[model samples]
Target: MVAESGNGVHLLYPVDLLNDEANRDLIKGVLGTVAERFDDDDTKLDQSVFNAARITKLYGVVANKGDHIPLAPWRLSRIINAPERNAVVTIEQLRALVPVAPAKLPAAKRRGNYPAFDLLDFLTRLGIGYRQDMHEGRERFKLDHCPFNADHGCGEAAIFQKAGGELGFKCQHASCVDYRWQDVRELLDGPRESRAGRATANGNRPGEQNAATGTAGALRVTYRRVSDVQAQPIRWLWQGRIARGKVSMIAGNPGLGKSQLTASMAAIVSTGGLWPVDRTRCTQGNVIFLSAEDDAADTIRPRLEAVGADLNRVFVLDAVVESYTADGAEVRRAFNLKNDLAKLETLLIEVGDAALIVIDPVTAYLGDCDSHKNAEIRALIAPLSELAARHGVAVVCVSHLNKAGGSDALMRVQGSLAFVAASRAAFLVAKDPAGDGTRRLFVPMKNNIGNDQTGLAFAIESAEVPSAAGHIETSRIKWGAESVTVTADEAMTSQGDPEERSALKDAKQFLIELLKNGALSSKVIRADANGAAHSWRTIERARVALNIQVNRAGFGKGGIWTWRLPHTPPNTAIESIERHTNCAAAYEKSGGLCEEKPKRNEPDWEEF
Candidate 1:
């Protein structure tokens, strides 16, 4: 087949000659003639080649030769004339032949032991072109030859030069920096130098690839082991403990000298004297007394003076109740002592460090004592505790005993158990039932930080009394039944008789009446009831007999003592009436009186 070109004819062999070396060389000679002729007109032959039929013909040629022939013309031509040529070439008939050399491999892939520049010269001999420019927008200029001149026209032979042991060419123009290599092997055989991974078209990883990159392993936590020598130091509730910061509850019934003891503590702490504990002393500082129950001018000042406290060092905030609110309803608001504590902070800052802050009769500052609400109680003490901790001051809160008392456990405290639970240490005061005018301040009803079995027992002597004038004395005593030995027989014998029980009940009723008006010291009330058939000891015995409990006031001058009813009087009365009233009519009315009363009555309602 033949195709026509602008100046000559393109002869296409009906048989694919590219598979035959003789035929390929013949075809190249014909094309080279065309190229030489076109060179005069400053033109070149346009070569368009396809491999579709060439591959099929190459297979048949290989089979006829009994082995595949190397495609390169130089290698194939040598093999064609060998002694085995008869066995290979005689099987296939020559359909057609053209005058052309075999097509060369791509220059970049060509390989030899020669240097790079020499190999590049060989590529120019193969009619390949190479050009370099400064990459102006997008154009390249030729330095050696003008394409418009026929004498120096572009062609494989005109541009390429064969250096020693090399077969490519370089432009000789002084300004031309362009050069073409004869072999492509140098480009392909060089190191790839690719990055670890391929970049996407938009230069980011795919979402899944990003997720893989973002994956992380689990984290580990480390804990250090500490030796005994490196352990944190423990704090005592008394020594530096009290001074460091602690909320101490000084509780007594009515007047077991709680206020007076608080006053003395204020005086001592203000003077930097040792507190009357187990002989252990605490460093003292300024004292602020928030006494809601005492008169500053008439009561606290005189009492503090009597105790020999420097009035200047002792600051008595006797008007906390008034300052917080006027009406008792506002008393709840007073329970939150934070605002008042702010003033306290200013005072501390002004006066230097304060060692102790006292809030007497804590019930007055508490929101609601009867509710037993934990949150209300917590709100009441949290700030106070915080203030103490913040300022490194000992906060002493005075509380009263509950009506239903027993051992100085959480339940015995006046308000919610949370009150005692929240405190660092709680001291309870109850009068000595034996009429010694001495009170027993139970160690701790509750002590979160220290021992609960250690407490102070002291006698309260009034300086105002003629016998005790100018002298305030207190004696320390200790008595508890934790390890006393009593035989079973002795215990049975000591039990009270029925008459004694009845007398105890009467005494209990009297004590209940006294407590209704607020706590009264057992000493003062005992003197008032001196003539009554029941002695203080007998009353106390009856209390124990009937399971009635009382808290003792600790020792100090003017230390007031008080008591609480074992049970509600109305309930007790109703119970007693139900048990005693056994007449048929009274028995029938028992259900109504003891339970609920009926609205309607019958004709026999009054009969007994």
Candidate 2:
């Protein structure tokens, strides 16, 4: 197919034609000019007189005598990889078949008697100074400490090679005006004259007639061996919870304090606080939090203060407007994980030395993209993950749970499974079944990095912090407990069949012991119940089964509620009443010694 104008498109030639020397040599000069002519216009492609094989192949037959093969993009690459031998495949020969057809390709630098064992032997033998530097956003081997600049400190002398056996050099240094291409040729003792630009290393000059492809701007790729890659240690923001240079996910149901947990994490990161599991402290650094739901001043800032976070190091990404209308109204609003990632990356650079980033409810940022599609979701997070790895920062994306009451907690996390799959570590926050009302737990749903995974317990409590505008109520998390063995299943595991797990049995035993003393307030009971390793739900179940009586006294906000066993009377209370009655009876028997009976509402209650 001919590429349309304004698309900046260019076609790639087949590997077989590209590797052929005769075709490569003949097409070198005319590729750029000819490709530009036939790229968009069909005046060239109108003329086509093909052989019987070409005609039959269109219908997907074998074309031995009469068979056609299906034409497709995927199959094209495979076809080029395994081409039939003994075929006329030059530009002029192809022009005879389709005189007006468009074309495309590649070309590479020449090396004499090219052998697999020693490709860069010439450069190595001469001890030419070169270094790997970034060009067009990729690493390329280029001349370093220019041969001409070595004595004069000219930084811009560059050496390059072309496909037609030519060595070129140009001093980019503004002051060094005497340097030319011949100077390098005279030094390296290479070809006197040739074309410029590195070709596709495999030896092709752009294209050869109809040896064409639909892939645009085709350039060869270079690779480095595994030994050449730099090694780095896995860093953890919270040991076994969040890791740096990797995407980590924390998911939970709404109102389960997932955001609060994230804020607490940010607090720790900003202040260099100790982690719960190992007490390992992280170096203090700025935290970039992108929150779409909470108010920065009211909800987020207060929550941070409650957690004792350093306010200076915490930054809330308020709004990211992609474009605006004539009236200056925002068009694309806020940080979109799919589209505004580049903007977020820019923000990362602005806040240099950033250690952590929190994207609360990451699904909110995937504007207009289908979250359920695995490919789309993966594509969205992959770049952000790469950004994290590039900056050596821990990226935590918060997500909500699906209401699908499934047995697997991780699967219940809403949207594509890739959200969890792509994360290096995945965590879940939920009200702990075995914890007090103030208790919440961080469960390791998935740990792809290592096996030191363990569940952490924390408590969410309201703290009254004094502010300029009076005391403010804020929520904070406290993590000072031992690691628990409960898996993520604790969040989704149903007690519907209390018989399945001993959690109910444990709750019953704990409650029986706790209530054995007498009636206790439900609040205290619930807290102690959780502290005793009994889920509050199970405790409520046991309370129902045991037929415990719940009583209320007084009224309004000042009213108090209490729990008491139906069969057990207050024995201590009964004994005290009996002793008072006996004393009153003895006083009456003593006549004058008997105290005057006071009104029923009298404050004193003694019998003389």
Candidate 3:
């Protein structure tokens, strides 16, 4: 396209050059590669400047002058979008696109500058130097003069435009590594109006209400058609036991090793221990705990060390400052989960990549909220659940069971039903009905993410830990050999009172006294119990319940199975068993009653 003034000075510009992304950049190269000369005044065009056909066709929006065509922001897309290819100028309609706030002389500048501002030019104008080079297949500038460390002139600072046309800045220099992209914007283009009503660099208009949130612009919430929603794979913190980015509840009676088991898991996360059924290694990260119940030094830390956790990665969040004293000192109080969640969020940010968080007995930190109230419980847990999701951390909320024994383990959780309802998964730590009281089992009570998995067994072992005072005794978790094939409901079934467990224990002693001298076949043992006027099936149960081994030793026609005590001496066993033989209450107290003997023709009775 060519244009001539009434005085016959002609200007020529290639149409293709106007649409190039680097139109400003090529101008320098174009001037260096081509020569320019003034034309004679005697030269004449076929028509006058105002009557030129191409001027009318490509004028875009003629704001105030004909030489300067104000490219309409609305029709700039004609380079590709508009089919007619008509670039007719609309008068002054594109003035908003070329804001003249910085145009001191009011349109003295030509079309050489395109971007509202150039970062490189801004830096150079500020006496900062730069070097242009190719980066990631795109042109970028590396600072020859670091604004933060001008004396060192660190070469790590770089500037480039992002895919969406936003300018980005990054500095690998240690001193300026923390500088944000927006900080660079403030330095290049004068500091932006940092009020709510100001347009954000990301394109949000000042004080505009977000459509999705229906509130002040806080964050951008994007949506997609329901059919376009992609499904995310379920992530597990402990295989199927707990889920990541979700709140999991652990409920149990006190002293059931709930804290110890959780500490053991935290230790595993800190150390990158065996994770899956194959025991493959996973990445290690930090474990944070807000244990309101246990003493940090003696209980939490010792247990962590006992479980082989990286001590450095184990953090205990005790409390944050609640108020400032009159003397200008701080009055600190325990961190309350309901009120001080923002403080917890700050703590999570400080300890980034946290893998797990433990709020021992979440009710303890409920502050003034009533744990038993469903609404209040929901309110207390909502922020925490969101925090867990935002940080991709598994938040384990420890809880004790309601005193009501023998109810649904989920309902037994000491709080409103929301305690279990709000959690994605809930677990129960109970005395192993099959093992001694020292052994505990982790049973999945509720799992909304997947099928309820088989339970795992663990026991508490006494470990001596070094403390400021001296060595102290604390318990650490000892996982069982394999996961148990028991449901939480099944496990809780035998979770009877202490009296019942004691009765069964006493019956075992009675069985030992009855069989201490020699091994007896099942048939003969039942015969002896029947003859002695004791519950034969109950004695048989006791015989099988203890550590006694059952074997078949007789050969040929005399072959028979016998139950025998392995380590118990006949003399000592006889003396001990005497105390329990006459007590029928042992069966009654232990809730261990014998079923009637089966008929010979029917199926044989199963050994206890």
Each model's TM-score, in the order given?
Answer: 0.38, 0.47, 0.48
Per-residue lDDT of candidate 1, residues 27-119 (tens digit): 444444455455443454632232323332221122222112222111121111213222222213332332234344334322232223333
lDDT of 3: 0.63
lDDT of 3 by residue, 404-434 (tens): 4443566567756667877999998988877
Query: How should the candidates be ordered by TM-score, best one leading?
Result: 3, 2, 1
Candidate 1 TM-score, C-alpha based: 0.38
Q: Residue-wise lDDT of candidate 2 within 1-608, one digit each (tens)?
A: 22322212223243234534344334433443454356452343211111122231232222232112121112211121323444444566544443343432223434332212222554575465666454322223466555533423333555544322233455655423434445443334322222222345444433322234543333345588999999977887776567889999998877878888888888889999887777889778899999989989778989988888999998888877767899998876666787678888898898887999998888878876656555556667778889999998999889988754334676677776668877888888877776664677788889888553578888777888777898889888777468877778755564124453477677766776665545555655776876787777667767775687787634674444566655555662233234334444555588736454322222221210
Q: Pick out the ten consecutive residues of candidate 3 with the lowest summed lDDT.
A: 69-78
lDDT of the candidates, in the order given: 0.48, 0.62, 0.63
Residue 292, model 2: lDDT of 87
